[model samples]
Target: MIGNNISFLKGEGYDFCELKEYEYGEDVKNIDWVISAKMQKPYVKVFHAQKELNIKIVSFLNGSTYFGTKKFKQEVITQIASMLGFICVKQGDPFASYIANETCELCTKKSKKIFNVNFMAEQLFNYDVIGKNIDYEFITNDLFKKIHHKSIIFLIGDFFDIEKLDLKLLSKKHEIFAIIVRDKFEENPSELGNVNFNDPSTNQNFEGVLNSNTIKNYVNKVKENDHKLFSHLQDNAIRFVKIYTHEDATKKLIGLLK
Candidate 1:
């Protein structure tokens, strides 16, 4: 099945050139007559080989001390990252990650120094879960410079605001898999029932009540903001999905890839 997919991609054509010597494995029909005559040697035509669907799991674990009222987002981030990383490794795909503190590393099967899923999980888990700030613009720029090849970047965050990101820069090279993790309390702050709420990042506090209209308004705002973000992804051909902490994340992920 993988070979067939590669063949189909070749038929459709690619942007790069591939070089190969005359070999029995190659299609003899692709032989270059001019090159063979000029060189006075048997030289085969070199067609660009299509790369398989390479998947790279990119996660940003912003625990920030107040991720959720229940399970910590950092914990969830590490677990999911490990799960996906293991899956990709089993599928023979490369894995890479940038934790909240911006510790970046690449995991490859062919590496002399093995960086397996356990190593990735440990790095993600032991990473500082509190007070780690993000500079999305800088991160995006660095990603472009470093990972020049195409890939799927799964970004996990609370998405407290859009200010931290430069989506256009990332969209230029990657198909983003935006995973926004939200808890019921955050989604419906009023559900906490007449209590003080604090901005996890800044530690700013505000008091609010659980009125029907307030809940409705907050839900609509979240939905609208999510719609805008997904619209950006759609416009750029990037894949995006929103998952709630109460929901089954793995199911949603499998559905998205399928």
Candidate 2:
């Protein structure tokens, strides 16, 4: 069952296992009445195919100092992570997450010992936004290697610093997703007049005149970058979703799931 769930979700192969005979307490929706009738017994249907969906959610949070903008990227990451964790548990999917520090945490389904509200909250609270020279390749590689079966991976970040990413490896092994965090303020500052700019990650100073011309130029540059990013991901068969700090993460995630 576990392997099937993983493989199905990972886009690897189609297979499934027989779920435990429908227990009385199980939701009625899960009961396979057809199989029971065929068997001439009270046995409910269970999937024996390898495609039983076992969900393993991997989220990459932006645990860098530069993420402390008015958008509160950290909070957004935490909320999405928590919400996703809850959803996975609700769906009986085994869940796991990878933080920037190479922390590999997993939660077995309904495992009181493995996961709970407090446990997830602690992981969010203890996360310190520090400046680290993180190798995304290492993280992505580790995730693909350890993740033998199929799973969903959420790579959430501003990606202001990622020079290049090799998603083919990830896409080939697992179903991949990229959640981009963008701030409106960065996109258009002309309305704000002359304002100093600072890089969130490096705290680098960027003193510039936020005049009409500069604003137009910045907006154009941002749009160009967006186009390039979209094209690159699309060409690689990777899905990309954009989330603005001004928008709600729940709405965005739900839309993606649909």
Candidate 3:
């Protein structure tokens, strides 16, 4: 379904980059007729091998991703990662995956093989996130230091700790793409009267009345948090997309990268 996604990074090379004077034995079909006519000589479109994109999939597997009304957020992230890995495999570009939380681990090594992609997705789907909270500062710092070359990093997470998240330095050298996976209820919650809330990251539980005021306050806080987060991303020129639990991860990703 996502076969045509990320047209810019079709996971293959030999892209039509420029036009040059046609050489002997060059295919006539590739000739740019307009340019050829203007130059009074045959000029053909030249295809240069596209640079191998170092694809890095970073999964922030915090406890919050364990919840969802239809499907778990982690599952959605896994699906997205699988699709991305497939893209890398098809294009013959090496891709790796990292799972970041209180501790970070390289879930998959740099390889164009299909096994790594499946392994990465499996690792993500089964990861235990009960008490795990993302250390964004550490993750970003490590990523900046570890990846010496420029890369296309796809960050999949809920971003509950947006205040602590900073990617300015990382974005300077690498392209950052944030895939925020969330449940709709988290964004626009309905009043449940009296309820107990759990801080998934901290494993802290609190009992409170989930009335109109609470819902209003929570929704407003979410909006404010997103505003700040989006502003920071835009200022750094980091591209991003939001995928809800009920949404198609493939379509959202295609729209973002295509």
Candidate 4:
């Protein structure tokens, strides 16, 4: 069961085993004061090597994910989530998933079962991108209450309108690995004559001629936005990976994991 596999690790090599009465040969510093106070006797912490690890994935799916030049961003999210789930199962760890789009769904699996992993992956793949906008702040705030244990978190999204403070707060509780998926067109639009651009998230329409000046400004804006997000992640010590829609998801994910 999931509860059976739960364990705690401490320090460089100390894995918490249990608490017991202080023995003659036990180190005085190892005493668990709170436990001893409750028991009216001295207790020392014990240690052993931890045997399992837990992994949690928080996926943010939005309408922007549907726009892609090659493979859809939603597909990339599924592939990456599936890969992590398989890795967790192979490591004999419990895997949990919290997917957010217009609404949120939590899949908490305690067993190391392939079925559980595949179910989560399928949910991600089939998620519809009908959300008006991704409320990343709201999602992160909800996650703060839901997640109680220390686990590796995979935060997957295009991050169109994410707040830096929310990410910082989320990272404080768990080891966060950020995956920013993007389409080629998002980074650089084709220099077509005059075109009407629609914002997928807001359903807003913008009509403009794709002249040299317009393209330059658009590219620069995209670069500036990406740089800011990257800098914030780096400053907070969050591991970040960028995946393009056109790239092979398996190869890219493997390389990033390595």
Best by lDDT: 3
**Candidate 2 TM-score versus the reference:** 0.68
lDDT string for model 4 (80-110, tens) is 8888888888777878888886655686566
Q: lDDT per residue, candidate 1, 13-125, as tens digits?
A: 34324534677776777667777777776676543454554555666655353465667666666667777776665655566666543444343332212257778778766
lDDT, candidate 4, equals: 0.78
Please give the ranking of all candidate structures by lDDT, highest first, separated by commas: 3, 4, 1, 2
Residue-wise lDDT of candidate 3 within 49-148, one digit each (tens)? 4566789999999888989999999999899999999989988788989999986689999999999988898899999998887788999999988999
Residue pairs with colliding backbones in model 1 are: none
Cα error, residue 107 of model 3, in Å, equals 0.3
Per residue, candidate 2 scores C-alpha lDDT tens digits across 27-105 of 6665567776776655543443344343454445544524534656666766776777777666665566656533444
lDDT value for model 2: 0.61
Clashing pairs in 4: none
lDDT of 3 at 225: 91
Models 1 onward score TM values of 0.70, 0.68, 0.84, 0.77
Winner on lDDT (2 vs 4): 4
Model 4 misplaced regions, further than 4 Å:
1-48, 107-111, 163-165
Task: After superposing candidate 3 on the true structure, give the runs of residues whose Cα lies further than 4 Å from its correct spot.
Answer: 1-47
For model 2, the stretches where C-alpha displacement exceeds 4 angstroms are 1-58, 63-71, 101-117, 130-134, 191-194
**Alpha carbon RMSD to native, model 4:** 7.4
Which segments of model 1 are wrong by more than 4 Å? 1-54, 63-65, 101-115, 191-194, 205-217
